[model samples]
Target: MHEVDMTKCLLISLNEWRDRREDTSAMVETVHLDVGRFTCVEPDQLVTTYNAAVQGTWLDGSRLTITEIPFVGRCLICNGTYDPVPENAYRSPCCDNPLEEIVSGRELRIRSIDYRSDAAAALESAPIQRQR
Candidate 1:
C-alpha cells in the first residue's frame, strides 16, 4: 500500500513537469522541489522515490534538487526571528525569547524554471519544486 501511494505521488509530480516540458525550443534540466520541514516527508525517502519516479520518462536525465524549508519563526519572548536548527539545536527561549509566528520558509512552489526558447520553437519549462 505504501509503495503504491509513493509511486502515485512520484508519477503525479513527474507528470506535472512533463506536461510543462518542451522540445525543439528548450530542454528540461533542473527541478527544484520545495520540501517543507513540516510537510512530514523524509528527505532520504523522498530522494529515493524521486529518483525512481523520473526513470523511463521525459524527466529522465534531469536533476531534482530538494531544498529544505526550515521551520523559522519569530521569538515571542524576544521578537528575534531565526531559522530553526535541528531538534537538538532548538531552543524555546531563543535569545531569551520564545517563538511565535513564522515569517517565511513554509510554502512549497515551483518558483521559476530555467529554460530557453527560440523563434523556431516556443518551448517553455516550469519549475518542479521549491520552497520560498
Candidate 2:
C-alpha cells in the first residue's frame, strides 16, 4: 500500500525535525494531516499502517489525526463550482463542462506536530510543515 511509503516519509520528516531541535527527549504525541478525498488515501488504513510502522521507534504510540478535505471543482466554461461525485461523472452540473479547475480536495500535507518534552513538562507544538 502507498500508506507504507507515506509512513516512511513521515518518519523521515519527524526524525529530521527531531534532529534539528535541541530537545532529544521530546516524544511525538500526534501528527495532524490534511488529506483530500480526491487523493484516495484511506484514513483507516493509513492510521493502521502508521501505528504498525512506528512500533519500537521514537514515534511509538503516536497517533495520526487526519482531516478530510471535501472535493470541490470549478467549471471551465461556466465558472461555476460544484462538489463532483461519481453520479455526475465529475463534471460541471451547470454547463456540462469538464471540471478543469480544482478549488480544493487535492491536498495532502502535514499541518503540524505536537510533542511532549520531558524536560519542559509541557506540550509543545512544532511548526507547520507541508508535504510536497
lDDT of each: 0.60, 0.88
* Pairs of residues clashing in candidate 1: 32-129, 33-129, 33-130, 34-129, 34-130, 76-98, 77-98, 78-97
| Local accuracy of candidate 1 as per-residue lDDT tens digits, 50-102 | 67877786656666567878777777777677775556344554474444576
Across residues 11-119, which tens digit of lDDT does each residue of candidate 2 receive? 8889999999998988999999998989888888999999999999989889999999999998878777899988888989888887789899988888999898886
lDDT (C-alpha) at residue 9 in model 2 = 88
- Model 1 lDDT, full chain set: 0.60
In candidate 2, list every pair of residues with a backbone clash. Answer: none
Against the correct fold, how does model 1 do in TM-score?
Answer: 0.55
Candidate 1 lDDT at 87 equals: 61
> How far is 115's C-alpha from truth in model 2 (Å)?
0.7
